[model samples]
Target chain A: MNESGHNGLVERVAHELKRSIKIDPSFDESVMAEVRRHGKPAMWVRVIAWWRRPQQLSLSPLSMAASAAVLILAVAVSPVRFGNPDGVEPIAEDPAARVIRFELDAPRASSVTLSGDFNDWDLEATPMTRTSSGEWVTTVKLVPGRYEYTFVVDGDKWVPDPAAPPSLFDDFGGTSSTITVPEV
Target chain B: MVESDGQLVRSVLAGDVDRYAILVERYRDRLGRYAYRMLGNLEDSEEVLQDTFVRAFKSLKNCQDPELFGRWVFKILVNRARTAGSIRGRRDRLFVTDEIAILNASDMKQSEYGWREEIERALSELPADQREAFILKYVEELRYDEMAEVTGVGVSALKMRVNRACRRLRELLEGVYRE
Candidate 1:
């Protein structure tokens, strides 16, 4: 075919290919269902639940951070207000909740957040504070259970915990590090 | 004024989970078409589309520029389509045109149906990368930079692929299309 004919064929094919596709009636509903399944509870509600649970705070120093001392607090002894949004007074702390510390050495990151199934994978639910030594740290009082989580670096990059075991399943292009807290 | 994609993304991120439906609805058909053309079947395309949406939702916080959500999701869809295509493999792809033609036989005139079949056949004949480059450049009408973002290929290489695809497609379709 000549140049004009070739161009015409390309344009014709483009037009044919651009025809609108037929989507199933339930497409939006189906997507929303999946999204809802991953929806998270409010931070305050989770924090409150954490306070009410039995917690035995253990300060086991991880091998990755030899100088990074773990902060252990007796839940029953300390008055804790865990960024409570409702301003509800802290209830009497239960002595059984286990405080697990998560740390990442990201000296350059301006911010880091923890996301996991335990917190319904809510990224904003757990922000990690930066230490003077440049390790990002946050402690969550999780009850005895298996949890899959990744650290959000600089609010946009997801990094799995190097010190923890990787979960068997990687989801949505992010790998999660799994930690199993045994029954206290 | 209509809400920007960024606005919708913000609402969805700020606990308005329902706002996500807008984003899904807005991009579904376009992305579905791309997936269908790339994967050569409705089942595979829809599955890829669904996976792309769910993946985007799960990682929405990682979308640095919410205003470009459409592009971001399209990138995910491209990757998923590539994976699905590779896994399914093109070993049985000779019949893909027949499968699609039969499925839509009732919807078009006989001549139009035959022509469409020829086009799909020609498209499926191109290597996957060339086919992808062709479709994104022509059918989707994306600029070279945008195509680069979606496919992660440099502009010069993509231009080469598109040229080769057009030449190959013309050769494949000439016999049937020429009077």
Candidate 2:
């Protein structure tokens, strides 16, 4: 009995039979078109324009370090909210920030505040605006160092800041993006 | 042939601006076939091929060898396929053509053979890695070393995969073996 209990020779012969390929007449043209799509655009200006764009999303800071921190918080932890829209957004720039952004999908609690080392554990440095999506954002900028923060979901709940850098030590705590503020 | 891709990449990176056509023309067919076989979906295959070329073009500077453009491009396609494949719950099936090809493969009646469909069904039954090794080595006709480079697997592991594929295929084609 062969491996499958079939005539091993016939199976071997059949295995010898390769899939006959009929390269579609259009195959070359279509793949060429794809090639063209991937190739830089014919227009120098356009190709240059496309080249200027970052290949992968700059996960940390998207350019405007200040705007990034605010947008960073907005884009991150997009699921919750700080109590009200009543404070200036702190601009934290330096060492291109690396952070995981999430949108708050729910409403703010009566005692929503951001707490982190940047604020010396102050839950009142800045208030967050509640967007229609129920997102609250705060830009907490720290020097080139690792810091931990969380959202005071409500007065009693001490939750990690959703927009903050992810912390892998959630076993003892939660997730936070490790921001590498470059030393200029 | 590989030199052309390298030249195009250099030109594209240096802002020479138009040498990419040669690279595209040179690689489109081969990479398309590889991508099609890897993913089975025509649109996705095409997308992966396009993306592979785009990424390969963009990251051309980082490529260690301008000479091994084929291998480099294949790696891009493989990575793209693997990433996309991982996301899908079902494995992508492989067919030689981007869309179904009606033309016949090279005549091989020199050996008594089972129906093409049976071979395909059997070929599909092997695990993904084994099937990959089998197709690349036997169908695509890549050498064991080349398969290792393309797959990023060690040669021994690739051989194991090929052996497993042959064994599984034999089991799948019992009737042929019986005959």
Best by lDDT: 1
Residue-level lDDT of model 2, residues A1-184, one tens digit each, is 5434444543453344343323345644554465456565345434544564335654445456877688878958675456545544543344554443323434745445555434433435545556766776556545565654556554335455555566543311242223445554
Q: On residues B79-151, what C-alpha lDDT tens digit does candidate 1 reach at each position? A: 6787677656634556486455676789879988888888888998888889999999999999998887676
Q: What TM-score would you give candidate 1 relative to the actual structure? A: 0.61
Mind giving the per-residue lDDT tens digits that candidate 1 earns over A81-109? 56765656555543566999999999999
Q: TM-score of chain A for candidate 2?
A: 0.35
Interface RMSD of 2: 13.4
- Candidate 2 DockQ, CA atoms: 0.08
